[model samples]
Target chain A: MVANHELQRAEEWSGLRGFTNLLYKENRAWWGTRRWWINALLWTGMLGGLAAMVVFMLPTIAQATDDPAVAKAGGPIPFGLEMGRTVFFELGAMALAIGVIILCQDLIVDEKQTGLTEWLLAKPVTRRAYVLAKLVASALAVMILLVALPSLACYLLLSARVGSFFPFLPFLGGVGIMIVHTLFYLTLTLMLGTLFNSRPPILGIALGVLLGGNLLAGFLKPLLSVTPLLLGKVASLTAGSQPLPPELLLYPVIASVLWSVIFIVVAVVRFEKTEF
Target chain B: MNQTHDHVIRTDGLSKSFGDVQVLKSVNLAVPAHSIFGFLGPNGAGKTTLMKILLGLVRPTGGSGTIFGRDVVRESVAIRERIGYLPQQPRFVEYMTARENLTFAANFFFSGPQPKIRERCEEMLELVGLRDKADRPIKNFSGGEKQRLGIALAQVNYPDLLILDEPASALDPLGRQEVLEVMERLRKHTTVFYSTHILDDVQRVSDRVAILNRGRLLTSGPIEQILNGRDGVVYTLIVKEAPQGFSERLAGLSWVTHVSAPETAGASVWQIGVSDEAAAETALLRFVLEDQNVTVTEFSRKKYELEEIFMELVKGESDGRQS
Candidate 1:
């Protein structure tokens, strides 16, 4: 019996035993259904396909229209750079923020409300492992299908419109910025889901923070230093004629990462203290 | 940590309350290892709350508990690692099939090869008789099927202690019998600690039982001892053609506390309450045989059913509170 107990303990302590199973379950829920592919195609069309249309039509409108202001406004900036800027900063970031909130707002809330959290936590898995697995799995899915793939497709369409001189390094930095921004919302939504049992409160608070923070940062300049809105400037810094210095991006990146960590820590603590 | 410890679960002064509502009040329990211990209670009696406390799914407001000599609050993860729990309403991911659910549960404890995990899943499926419907989504399952799968998932790890909260509370008679059979088969491998309001099921399978009501433990002991009446002993006698004053004469004796003939038109069955079984056996039988006109047909000790004992204890406690 002692030997058997020791053997069981050894087996339980193995690499990612509980976390991997949870991850697999999460991935199966997302990828094993048709919802993932449909969402991916919908996002690609909305973000990438729209950027392509704008890029392809801008030159024609510049030549076809008699208005010199329209031609000049569309002329000075390279078409590829404008497309990258519009897709990365505006459409891509906004869609990802909203998409992540929609995807993650119910991740913990549904489980808790349906009594699945109690069932899962009754197993040998730790609370931290369970929360982390959901966060990690959802983050990976959103990053790959929602953010990275669409951003790449937008860049390719932009390149096809103009010459192949796409500013690759700066564009990569912008995508990284968008990713960090999306992580803020994802982690925040997950944290709120952990803190509350209902979906409306989590959704309202997370989305309110996303949209309200942007509007608040515009009026209050000091808020820009700490809020995730600084990530919005990544496209302007990368593509526009007057680009901000590269060092200016460090503060917001660090701040976003710090917020993500804080949200995750708070979530783990709240989840650990929760009773069923 | 002590393997030689006899009790698989031990709790002392285990109390819990949600704000002003006290659910469990100083519940001390010691469930012996390898025994099918029944936790009997009415609705809202804190049976599920106590099970959650033992499983460490809920914290105790005031008290401590230990499973296998491990602190419930501090070493709960270690405690849970060896125990299997089925909640009152067992909920699974409805999208997953029975096999997928069991495999997912097994992965938490066993970190072996894929084949080994699959083998374990197959074993649990067969154990619960879900092998035929292993691939069907659990959302399509019946209530009994879901409960059977819940049992299989609970025991997937081959735990030393299985805590099931009302394992057969929502099943039909046949379904309840199948679940009880599975639990009976599991007795050789693990100790089964289950809670239910069904006294008949407890009487049939459980070796020991604890009765809880209104957040307090009214009584707890072995089945035989509890059924034998904790206060005193009583023998039942079936006599025919008794004289008019026989029962009155027996009741007048010092050893015979009370006598009642339960049936009027039948074999004149009389339940004789006794203060001492040895004295009653030595004298009562001789006295009964000495009567010339009386024909004694059946005579034996009367055992109370669990339902009767539970009702008596609960009502006694209620009357005590009222007084």
Candidate 2:
């Protein structure tokens, strides 16, 4: 019985050994990687801003709710503050977009310029693992900062403004939307990096896409007057004044999927054919 | 056979053309299980192209290759799962310490299991002789240390096959020794396919070598057999007193093609191309004692260095085949 057990243990040890070996073989190598501290420092900054914003706003939100006046209030501004609602969506959205691009830039373009791709290709790591780890890490960082931090900010700010309030459902919904949008954008950024394989070109491509997409939507708005295919149907959602038509509301989702799919295909294809 | 290593990579008639120039011309080579095979070549010899093809990084213009017997062009995942590669120039995230850099790398491979990784990371750091420098940032590391870390990372999981292209080219002598020593140690468990113009390195470590020149393999075999040929005769004869007519007598002798003067005064050395080296050895011994030398001290066979033979054969073959 002891002999059998020893044999089993030895077998299991070999199996573990094999797994660790595979982890090295199939895993993305860190050789030729861009500065890890840069990514770490960048992540800390984004999350730090969110933490500070939440900490600063939470007490004020609690005090406002205790007064009962703001809690029971209803007005065009949501409270009596001037030019306040713009601060919520406008600043938040812009911050989210900027943060997402910054994080993705390091993950994709910076790594390429540092010659990590050649090193990575020499290893046994699959293209899927390499790109996905990058996308996931950066996207997760974007989500934590863009979605989670902002969610906390909104909750504290909203609770303080309205008093005696929990905005859990709305916060979750916003975060969910932000995550989906970020993934879509992340996918686009990855494709651009793979296509260009250089810094200035990758940055130019990513910047062109984000800014160009919005500009394209604006340009397509006039065309929408003549045709249903135009951005007229989707661009109108930017107002946030009226409830969305189900199809029109799905526009971002659809566009996100479309772009993501295109990027996924391009990355997979480019990955297979490239020589180290 | 173990699944990960079974048929990991394969290729056939693999060729590549960078526009009008043909870089890899129908090149063929194979890596067996657990052997240090040196990809010997000069610059622009397409060894790099062959390696890239194995890695599935570049699309070949023609032909194919295999890593672990699997189709290199099609089943790269198979090849990838059992291999670790260190390119000629290895770059790391400069700002992060070796530890942090390794941790971030571990995440992509491990995905979870934090405790195990910490232990393994320490162990790997030790293996590459960088345990004490774990906390030191990679940017501050000298070229040797960074390269040591590079080798550590390459072997972290103890891959079955480690593909290192010119692993010691950028290193100083000490740095080169460190890398080569680590590779030597790793050879016990892993198969290393190292490419380099450094023939001494290949001579010191490689069991076998494949010489590539002008995008084609000039010759490939065990270093010993290939270097001196199977039966090529080499001799080192030391005499107590030298003869004035030693060169004249040795020169026109049958089966003796080349001769060189000795660094020592009373030493006579000659390399003869004889069909049977044993027969030539007997004949040379008789000729030396009977002909001229007053007394012989060290009369031993010459051991050819791989570097000299390699340069001669490959360069000669390429030059011979060029026009």
Candidate 3:
């Protein structure tokens, strides 16, 4: 005859064992699939690209920093400051173009293409939550890419160029500008990626918007030349030797913001309406 | 998310259409709690559409329903919170391990404790028989294995309602059997509402069935009830060859009601609707033994396949959709 106490203890032990077994099962999936390695490599390459670009630019920066002042007389800004500013502005513009385009490309496009779109959507999580998770994951991945590569290259280049890279505040400011431009581009690209399912079309549209905005700002600059107050419309772009008019600069920024918001809305709507 | 009502699912005057072609008509259906409910329809039938509407993934042109007692549209979140959906083709993050994928899914559903989430993932993996492969990346997984992984992910939150849309259709015979076995095991914890045109599967697992065609449910009830209907019983008699007036003689018998000559190659089959099982058996034996030319090939009760039953009910529904 078995004692009641012994029977109860045996039951409890089995229950605990059952739970332990369950935990082991959930952890098992990590070993069964090979797709995660590719994703890791993709992120690594993405960040590596930015770092490589910055490293490649080191010689041009060193040359520019070494050259004497180009102005004849009564210069408003120092020669070194002017050259640094030129490099910074060019870097900023290019970063904006690349970042927005890259960021706009969504993780969902592959999901949609691979027919996994229907499967994931059928799960318990809402579309809003799904979209939010992808955004957070992609954003974090991009942040790692942006900070690891560009900032590292800049820090190393400055250390090599100057004895101590003193006055790090201005350098930090330039990086901060890059960060904002990257965020704007990322947000813009994410929207475009979600709005369209194809990669080529999304890339095409993203590049078109980036270049078209700058070109349109240039063509419209003369229209506003009579009224310099419209300089705001061209604040973020450069045409020929002139920087964007502050008034006209607002147009591109607002346009980018609007596009980002609208594309996200489309993604959410499309996701909702889709059968999956 | 919502209070459990008498009916777990309710739809009234539901209809769906793609342009001029209507897939569903004014159909009404209700699934009871704690029972296996099967939705049976052919490939182009509106079963998937109906399930999507219930999930709020697809917008129906007309009609409405309450899933898990929550409005399928306005209260989709509440409904979704209590339901686990496994699609026909489940897609997971290819870069994440099965465990990592489950963890990612758990973040959205479980808000309690981190350890509990891990524990829940473990439980789900075990349920789907993927405990050994929990760390595997999805890209390396087989089609059947991925589907099992999909089910594990779906059960992360321990949902009360498990909605599977043709979860086994993609699998080969062994895979299909494996999936159905898992589904059988899952019934203890959740109410399984699955849609599939595979009659054998439905007949094996479902407590009740809803057969739909042309976007409208032709019949919805217990599988036995729908199958039994008002017909008595069909007796299928296969002879070595058809003798002249064989059909006429079977029809003339007092015990036989409705006689049908079904399509078959090697044998001449005569289906006779019998009034009483014992009497039909006696008479069938007597008639076959009395006839000298009769070489009995096969004789048994002709049970209706679910496909045949579904076709019989929804055969004319599409003609209405054509207009």
**Candidate 1 CAPRI category:** acceptable
Interface RMSD of 1: 3.8
Model 2: per-residue lDDT, tens digit, A1-276?
011112111111311222332233222332225434444445445544444454345445644565455454443224332113234343445455555665565565566667776776555456655665565555555566455654565456555555656445544554455555566667767777667666666667766765665667586764223222322223223322335675555655566667677887787677545555
Q: Higher-lDDT candidate among 1 and 2?
A: 1
Top of the candidates by lDDT:
1
Instruction: Report lDDT (Cα) of residue A247, candidate 1.
Output: 51
Sort all candidates by TM-score, best to worst: 1, 2, 3
How do the residues A43-80 of candidate 1 rate in per-residue lDDT, one tens digit apiece?
A: 88788877776777665655665656554556623543
Choose the strongest candidate by DockQ: 1
Predicted structure with the largest TM-score when compared to the true one: 1
Tens-digit lDDT track for model 3 on A83-176?
3334434543465456546544656677777766565555444665556555555555455454334454545544554456535554454444
Worst lDDT 10-window in candidate 2 chain B: B3-12
The CAPRI category of model 3 is incorrect
How does chain A of every candidate compare to the true chain A by TM-score? 0.88, 0.64, 0.57
Worst 10 residues of 3 chain A by lDDT: A1-10
Which residue segments of model 2 deviate by more than 4 Å?
A1-83, A121-124, A164-180, A214-218, A222-241, B1-12, B30-35, B93-123, B229-231, B234-271, B287-305, B317-322
Candidate 1, residue A189: the lDDT equals: 97
lDDT of 1: 0.83
* Chain A TM-score for predicted structure 1: 0.88
